[model samples]
Target: MAAAPQPLAPDPAADLALRLALTIRHDGQGGVADDLVDPDGLTRWVHAHAAALPAGELPFTADDAALAAVRDLRAAVRALFARAVPGEPSRADARHLMPVEEALRRLNAAAAAVPVVPHLTWPPGDGPAAGHRAAAAGAPAAAALTAALAHAAIAFLAGPDRTRLRACHAPRCVRYFLKDHPRQEWCSPSCGNRARVARHHDRHRPGAGT
Candidate 1:
């Protein structure tokens, strides 16, 4: 049987962090139904989501640059998976790989900054009024962070298989993918064939003897 795509390591915290990056990347690549959303917009939405959650905080600012950084990180992450391996982070063009590694480190750090109660089970309606007041008090930082965390968790986990979470193999399809089948050899078979022909020509042409 063909080998299964390596399962993502099971660390909900890390998964959630990665999810934010995935969502951001998905939005950037227009994979979430091809809306062509800006990375910043996604970040704002994530931030808002985390804020709404009771156990998180919002950052001080959701400015263009901050969102841009988030976008850049998302691109870096997508690139990392696009050039993947049997297990995890695979090697690729250094030009692309370095940025992705850097982004992973930075993004992980950013995710760590927000404090989240991994899984909280509050008694139903026991003291919701107090919780709301507390959330309101923490809106700027704590509340926003909660929304961001929840967003990241949902984005990272609970999605399609890893195949849909791949990078285009075509020379020109450098962007991430979320639709092509996992067994697909190329973003487009025509492109795949073109690459094969190019490789064959390079290997067998004139002076290029085996």
Candidate 2:
């Protein structure tokens, strides 16, 4: 059997939207590495981020169709950010927005049966808390998953942090990361080294800039 795919490293400051869009890695050699290609991987992804999901409504058995839908949604989100982030006058392409809109529609349809309400509670050994909960019992798991992802995407795009979203321009790297620091560019040091090497190679190419 193939080795199980490694879980994505968690960044306390990264939002769900950034994480979701990065499910596919652009190999810089004109190919992509998709983590959601298998049902088991998809299931693990959902479980790993269980906190964002509705209580006990995890989509642990993602079918082929569900996997395809999520992949398409991921692509659309990536494309949307690619265009929206760097442009002086940012604009969303209709093509990219369609899938997101469709996802949201499905989420709304699926959530029709669930009621969202706010509640307060004090954990047995923790401080009191207040938060909203979706009464997701009996709700379709696939729909709940889609809705949760869609909602996160919407919030990320519409919120103030959208300006800080960026795609790593490093060689052979296709990951998205939040600009936590003003000078940060690549997603990681490895990517940064790759980018520097590529630049050095380009500058030293035979008869370059002649």
Candidate 3:
């Protein structure tokens, strides 16, 4: 079986929105890779991201419609992510990114596709933490999943975590990541190494920094 185009380590704090944006990632061979290639891929992805999505009593299986919906939403998300961070965005889809307004419209439309309500919980000493649950129990699985993904994106964009979002411009790397430390530049150690090597080459080329 053909594997995903790009397979890299998962972010330590894998926020759902971040995860969705990461569905398209660097192949480490100077090419962009996509994970959601078909219905099976979508089903796997959704099931794997259970913690980040709304809880369903029954397992949600993806169909062609679900796959298409999520993929389109991802395009909007990645475009918005590009706008969120500083400097150049991922090269793979930079040329074809939808307009900012269009992206917002799509996100909103997907989010509203399913009715949802806040599920809140307050522990002993902590404030209430809010979560989501589809208001309609019988809503289509596809709609619920896509809406959940869209809702996660909205939360991520509006939350403080968005401030730390960064674009990894390391050589052969194309991803958006949350900066864990003040000095973190690349998404992972491998990317950092690649970037360092690239920089060293740039500094010690035949021209010798002319």
- The local distance difference test score of each candidate is 0.45, 0.64, 0.81
By the TM-score metric, which is better: model 2 or model 3?
3
Better of 1 and 3 by lDDT: 3
- Candidate closest to the true structure, highest TM-score: 3
Q: What TM-score would candidate 2 get against the native?
A: 0.73
Candidate 3 lDDT, tens digit per residue, 1-210? 985345333332248888888888888777878899899988888778776666682387778998999999999999899898878786656787999999999999998988788788889999997776888788787777778888878877877777788888887666898876677888898998988999999998898857
Return the TM-score for each candidate structure: 0.43, 0.73, 0.85
Cα shift from native, residue 116, model 1 (Å): 4.5
Arrange candidates by lDDT, descending. 3, 2, 1
Clash counts for the predictions, in order: 19, 0, 0
- The model with the greatest lDDT is 3
What would you estimate as the lDDT of candidate 3? 0.81
Judging by TM-score, tell me the better candidate of 1 and 3.
3
The superposed Cα distance between candidate 2 and the true structure at residue 2, in angstroms, equals: 46
Residue-level lDDT tens digits of model 1 in 33-116: 321155456555655545344443334445555555555555555554544423333122234555545645644654454444
CA shift of 99, model 2, Å: 9.1
